[model samples]
Target chain A: MTTGSGGRTVPRERERPGLTPEESALVVRIGVFVKMRWLAIAGVLIASLIATQAFHIQFSLVPIYIICAVMTVYNFLFLYQARHLNVEASDSLPETLAVPLRHLLIIPRATSPLLARARATGNVHIIVDLAALTVLLHYTGGIENPFIFYFVFHVILAGILLHYRVAYLVATWAILTVLLLIGLEYYEVIPHVHLEGFAAAGLYQQGSYILSVLLALSTCLYASAYMVTSISGELRKRQREVVALQQKGLTEKTRELEEASEELTTLEEGRQHLLRFLAIASHDLKAPLSAVQSYIQLMLGGFSGELTDKQRQMLERSSIRITEQLELISDLLDISRIEGGQIVKEMEEMSLSQVVGDSVENVRAMATDKSIKLGTRMPASLPKLKASGVRLKQAITNLLVNAIKFTPENGEVLLRITEQSGDIYTEVLDTGVGIGAEDLPKIFDDFYRGSDREKAGSGLGLSIVKRVVEAHGGKIWAESPNPEDKKGRGSKFTFLLPKNLVIAGKKQGRKARLKSQET
Target chain B: MAYKILLVDDDPDIRDVVTMLLESKGYETVTACDGIECLAALRAEEPDLMIIDLLMPKMDGFAVLKELEDGRWSKYRNIPILILSSVREEASRRRYELETALEFNVDDYVEKPINPEVLLERVERLVNKNKKA
Candidate 1:
């Protein structure tokens, strides 16, 4: 049920979920048709009034007014019908509902019946409007009226809204209707109700005028239809390509995200494996090592027998060295656990002030032994953060011990805790031999000791501190020749922790930690 | 007579050193190399207290604790158990805490790379507690 790369299967559902682009475009064009009809209705109404009332041109206004009323009525009907179709086309129905309509209205493939009906209605509108315009022109000198050229506008509308063949058919229909009107009037088959002052007298009867005018009108209508249809066809093609390209980009991004997630899963498994190895290795190595150290203690305690001072001193020294190695193994395990993201399981709401206080008290003896002055600068009240108190104490203790180890006798070490914005800042500043510039960047690396390797430590102390801080979603950095120190010889190590530390993969870590504990 | 302590570990070096340390302190120690031997020694020697290691060759400490809870060893149920672990003390303590919460009995834990004084002090305390109870 899953891919090899863990990528999700492509979705089968439609993205738009509404009408196909062809159906929607037809709905919009129907709206535009109604608007253009309204403009024509107004022009007819105003032109009739201006010709008879203002210019006193002798033409009966009753028929022209009646035609305007008819145009208004049909325009309203078209507007209402277009609104109903618009709602039907744009509604996003459930798949079950749409499936029933698939053959009838919801086909995303070739033109469905709904779109065909819309195109049919478009053709009918153009035919009816051309007929009305011819009737209106008949009363106003028929072929002599220049408004007869208005048929070309209908041809243009057809080109944009209908198929190429339909647009040409519409143009032909306009030409045939106009020719019928002009021929009927010229041959005296129908009476030409001429506008008395609008054109030269008897211009409607001129054979040369009719021929040249009809020639120009036919050429103009066909030209407009051809040009408009070709341009609109190219535009629709480009629109589809853009949609396809966008879909491709989305799929690529989804694949990339899935790959990254799988990589993280593999890395997590590797870390759990390493944690297991470390646990077993620690026990196997430290068990015998500790047993050896204990035997030395037994000899030193006179349990075996009373020992010479030389043997006692040597045993004590060896005991100290084994203890250091034990501590080093512990430090290594700590780093492993931190990197494995097990710290989240140990986290609880606790105050940083308490951890800082305990760490300071823990290192007080070491400081006193070195004759190093210890100082603290922190407010009485501090914010609580979600952190592993034991790990934090370990980190703070490492910092304090590192500071004291490098600081000479009578030197000063300061523990400063400050709250800034939403973060808590803890700085350990010591008046000791400052770190070299060459070693500053690598100080946080495991087993990286500075030029001051003469000082005793596992070299993993600062790295442990770094791991602990980062695991809690915090940052730690070191500054050599502490800028704020007047002595200008000490190093400053500061770590900033947010009031709320958010561990990544916290939920997953909890599950794994519990499982490891159960084992 | 001095109190008897049962020491269970798979490692020979740990058993020898710990037994020597306990004997030096005037406490007699019975040793078992694994959990099977630990149960056998508990029944045979009836030591005053048990110091068991967690990781072993057969039937680890947790399974042994579960076995003790099965009522077959109900007569020795009052015997205190001290867990000696080389795994992190927190992890071992948490495991034993869960076992005890389920009513499986264990008394104390000592992490290895052990400090001799601390181990002896804990062993003495558990043995005395067993006597008092």
Candidate 2:
């Protein structure tokens, strides 16, 4: 069974067969013991009535009648409990009945409150009632009783349910019951009354009864011990099977998880490859388009000396279309690379001032065109930090260009560099559209744009910035400088890089160099 | 005196653009659609320099360079070859210097869609160097 994300059981596989056919057959025999309880109760009751009438059998009729009646009630209770108890409950009840049942068997004429209590309760009720029936049989025919083998049945049932020690105790008690009955008959302590017809017809009296009692007692002890040991062996075997099945289940689950993880990794790799292709394509495409745009712009601006108003307008519209197309291609490429994990970082010790200056130079022309105030503040105390120069420049330039694009004419965009304990920080503070609180978290997500921004952007700038920062073991976050600083109070984007860089060893560097050289 | 230049490309548009640009810059230009046509043109006219695109139909630029290196025609072997294409930087760099034999030397490499100013500068340098040699 699998638990879904909602935590409900979903069926995954079916239950397997637990017990063999031979073991199942033993379970059926346990059923026979239950059936025999009822039959024995009925037999005892009928025998008692017959003895009173047929042979004018003389005894305390009331005591015998009361004993038989109580036995019948006990038998009925045992049957009811055995039928109702679930498997685990039934197994526990049998152990509780063990000692008391042993007492009942040994002292055949005795009764105890504990035994009576046990009789009213559990599967042991059946065994206790069966002991009572055995005692009655002794009264009717002494050791000559044909029903004496019922002691073996009781012992076998005890062996199947109780522990081995309990089974041994029960077997000993059964043997003692036989000895007690024979001793009583021999000593005449209890009336040596036997069934008149059977005793008279039989030639041997004391010898035959003693021998039959001995045989029955021995059979009961042997059978009980054998059943206890064999059933325990079977139970242990079943337990082993359950353990093995559980282990198999765990191994299969682990294999499935591994397979799923491998498949996910392969899919991720494929996505990254596609993203790389798109990024390269878009970058390459931009080269030619830029050339076309510049040539057209130059032509329209009368570098060729003059142009009509209509021609100028047509040129402007074409430029707009070409610009839009370029933006769309770049946005598609940026978003794909971010999602595909194509952006790899190379960590090295780099100067913050150099990185800032390079980024400024890259977007300087655009800033000039916008007439935006671009300034940088770098402290001489700023320590060199571990970072990827290309990736950091790409991210910082995107932020700077975004600022230059959005800020009004004469608006200020400041690049600030600072150092804290073992960490270097860079902040781009732009006097452009500030982001809203609700849009802050999702600003770093692919293709997300804040509603407050006026310009149409591909919305991939922040996402790229976020990826590059994280790849360099850094963090990127945004905050508005003030609530009242709406139009001029631009968003401040900050990122931190670790001061100490971990460099790969000589061998790995050599391998990387070789691979790059081969390409 | 105008310099004679041979331009080779599988793409007709690129060839037309480069030829037009070179001609307008006051150089005499000759065009070939493939390496075979280039070889045939070389036999008819002795150009001062050759510009070849890396990717081409029927016979590629590398094969043409290999043919030139093998000295099928002794006079053509000494001409300075300039590779111009949009092939990846690392691959192009290796193709130009690392893999080729000593005789198969490329004078310069320019990525496409060619910057006219850079192209003109490289062309002039190669033509001047060849004339001196």
Candidate 3:
């Protein structure tokens, strides 16, 4: 699989899965070890030459020069081998693939059985580096040489890259090696290589100087290792906490999405159940109401037999009541049909003035019965509107009939239609016992009747009108104390329909225009 | 000429009431329980007008219209069809027109709980209009 700059590419399963943690870490260690070896080779070569040729201060130069040359060549070879193993690490089964024998053939000095043991304890390579360093320090005056600073570098490297215990072991080992070197040179166990061509300083002969140099070198190495390990430990703990917080945030978002969809599904099911209940109940009521009215009308028409005036009067009243009940049921059905969101109304271009005139005529008799004045206020040349004419007429008729029911004798009811910014506004205003502030809020609600309502009737009319107005893509509302009234009297109901409702699904040159002559 | 009406509805009460109402106006009515029976009755006695209901068993009003359009009963093509039911007329009418690739092929729409005066006026007008045409 190809890894991008983003890292950790999604692998092609059939091609191969990615590497495991153990293999990846081991390969990275091999790469870092190769890099460290190159640094060591360069540092040794530079230090050796500065003392031998530049400073002319070296006693034994041939053996150190040969070791430096061999180290440079060996480090270059190890770099090539490291890259080869890394490629193998990526291509192999990614876990438990044994390190090749060549991996053990490290260090320019000698091949020891410690190759496998070095990888096991993981700090054995650092031990080998320390061995090489001990030899360099031996020729350079052991503890007296400023080159002893190299021990401090190895200690810091171990602290950052290896376990703390391993780093402490390596630091302690460096400190012990210095003391042993000073002891050997001072006791003449190994002959001291004092500067011959260079000026000989008694700094090496003074036992106090040797003792103090050893003390400072050992302290510096152990102190640096301790500080680096503690700092790195704190950084790692913070990184783990950040990762856990990100995972928690992801899980919370997923749960919220699940809950939102569940709520939507439950809401949809509840609406459907309610619509079914309304339709079945309405149809059942309609059937019997139809039968009762039919039988009653037939008897009143003298089909069964002649009736006395008293019996006829009673039958007529019952028939009228049944008719009113049937009308209420019809209005309730209309509201549910629209509220159920199951209806598709057929809209057409029709005259607003004509509709208003026709609806007002239907209510003229009611107004006459109450001696209430009914009228219209509209332009004679008004623009025609595109809407379902039958439903709009029903809305107007309901408003007018409501106004007449609440109005006292000789009160005024008016129908007005006008054009505003981009909508057609139809308003119905009535002057009578004005609506109380307490009743205004629930006036349009279904089955609602104000305590001050002049008469009792099915409260479904205004609710049906509200649904019809909304279904036509319009806004409807009512206000008390008609804005035109000076005395804060009368109620005004108005609704506005937009000039252009999208022609429902215009396909293949189709415009929904019911022919005017269909009437 | 006397104009006869064929009253088709699954509801027996609606059928009986409509027949009585129409007969009271001195027009004869032949009754049927469903669309299939209505089509058969139309063959036995060719009515001047047909009052059809949309929802019924054994066949519905639209199926009857389809069979009539297909000319299985070709002779009754000129008879006027009046839709008399509680179903929302405009929605069904548009559906029928779209499905048949024809315009709403009926004379008038009368929603049930109907105003009887309006039904009678439309019936008389349709019969007279057909005669004049």
Candidate 4:
């Protein structure tokens, strides 16, 4: 396989199983031929009845009725044959794969088996029609009948439905049939029934009239064959071009979609690489910052030497700033890892209350440092959940730290764990300052401090918690003015973990994978 | 006599600060830059406690922990080990736990940038506990 202009590997041309455009056109024309013959049969019956009953034209009806009856029988047979071939053509082929058989006109024997059969059938029908018309014309008025021009119609049909050479051959056959009829009638070899009122008397007996009529009809038949064959040839060529253009358009669309999909895959890979870089960069960044903090702590602890109160206070402030910077880096690392989908790899089965308990204990010291009482209310026996316990604790700790940071001294912060409706809800509520109504909706947005930009922690705290909750197939929401608090001056942050946590992870992964495939 | 402690870290700044902190607390200290040097130091002379960083060049703290568990180092197995590093990632902790199939075998795990007083308290507790044993 070699890459095409589209940069997609192109396979070798396959042997498509279907009818060519020429064959399809032939099938359609054959059906039309059958339908037109039914009209011819009806015209014959109606005309003969009108001639005998209405016009009182004197002619024996026996031969005329016999020819009409024969036409009816074969027309039914042709209808069945056309239907059978039409079904075969349509059922075996997809329409898009059909293109005109360019060489079939010059080399009919090289055509498909189905096309060969259809061509043979069409040729036989034309020849049979010519023979039948000849007999009917001879019986009606020999060379005087106006319906003798019907020979031109069959020649034109042959041009439309058969190979060009075959159409010429049909024209010759029609001309010979006419000549034979006129010769027989002239030689009195066959009895020529006469239309006594319709034409001049003994018109069949005039040699000059017969020869002139024969020449006009021969020229008319040859001209019809030549013009119709050339026109149909040009039509087929144009159809071939249109079909090829359509195929080209379809291939181009497919190629564009494939290119777009490949681009999406590359973009996804790039995003993954960026996330990995972020994780590594943040980790690398945090290392030296932590070292600086350690040195500051050592000095603050009087290990380097005694320091002035002013120097001590300044060093303490620097240490706090370093700690904040380190915390920000850790948050960045957590966000990147969560976005990178590594959180799913760390899931473990543990109790919901156990995680909440650990989180509360983690933040209790901070609450005490601020003189804000931290209380937890958990059900005595809680069901277990499958989740990334570390991420869960981080989310809970962020919420607690946020509450403790915002609340005033002696303000109370409560963490309550409750099981409801197949979900484990961990709610953190504080009694100091409630979030504004405008800030509630955007609190979970990345870097959204919601009008509280002066907060001590990274603004990514709530957003990271949101990502963690969603990664576990859960939801988190914030409400101002804690409904559970009697004072109505605090905010409540609650996140619920569904009992079927692992299924959520799988579903998320599946959705992501499916979206990639679609692109 | 002051109890001797081995401090293993790749960063010289951290090693200097921690060494100063330990010495200020009246504890003698030795320093090694990586797990390989730490192992070599242990062979030369065992200390009462080992305070090591988890991430380092040449060899990491986990490899040192695994090597210390070997029967060849049985005599030093009783010496208390404290893990001190900026790498507070649960992944590393989980890896160590999964490999050992037990609780963290170290005497204590302390994340970096900790209060020096708390670090000293944990260090003294481990050393005194080993002494009592």
Which stretches of candidate 1 lie above 4 Å from their native place? A1-26, A49-77, A86-121, A134-141, A184-206, A226-321, A336-348, A356-388, A399-457, A462-519, B1-83, B90-107, B126-133
Model 1 lDDT per residue over A1-519, tens place: 000111112232212247666566666667666766777787777877888889877888888878888888887877777666534554333223334434443334334656655665666677678778888988877887788888877776667666666567778888898899988988889998888887777787888998999999999889978887787767667756776787799999999999999999999899889878887887777877877887887787676888999999999999989989999989988888887888887787766777888899999999999999999987555656678888999999999999999899999999998768767798999999989999999999989988777777788999999989888889999999999888689899999987576333222222445555665
* Candidate 4 local Cα displacement, residue A64, angstroms: 23
Q: What is the C-alpha lDDT of each candidate?
A: 0.78, 0.65, 0.71, 0.80
Models sorted by DockQ, best on top: 4, 1, 3, 2
Q: Is candidate 3 or candidate 4 better by TM-score?
A: 3
Q: Candidate 4's residue-wise lDDT over B60-116, tens digit each?
A: 898899888889999899999999977774666887888777555788888887679
For model 4, the stretches where C-alpha displacement exceeds 4 angstroms are: A1-249, A300-314, A333-351, A369-372, A379-389, A408-411, A419-424, A433-455, A466-477, A496-519, B1-10, B18-85, B91-110, B114-133
Q: List TM-score per model, in order.
A: 0.64, 0.49, 0.62, 0.59
Q: Output the better candidate (1/3) by lDDT.
A: 1
Residue pairs in candidate 4 whose N, alpha carbon or C atoms collide under 3 angstroms: none
- Name the regions of candidate 3 deviating beyond 4 angstroms: A1-226, A297-312, A333-374, A379-394, A406-412, A418-425, A431-456, A460-519, B1-8, B22-50, B54-81, B87-107, B124-133
Docking band of candidate 1: acceptable
**Could you say which candidate leads in TM-score?**
1
iRMSD of all candidate structures: 2.0, 5.6, 2.7, 1.3
TM-scores of chain A across candidates: 0.65, 0.45, 0.59, 0.59
For model 2, what is the alpha-carbon lDDT of residue B122? 96
lDDT of 3 by residue, A351-469 (tens): 66667878999899999999999989864445556677777888899999988888889889888987686577889988877688898988889988789554757888888888888
lDDT of 2 at A475: 90
Whole-structure CA lDDT of model 4: 0.80
Q: Under CAPRI classification, how is model 2 graded? A: incorrect
Can you give the DockQ of every candidate in the order shown? 0.47, 0.10, 0.24, 0.53
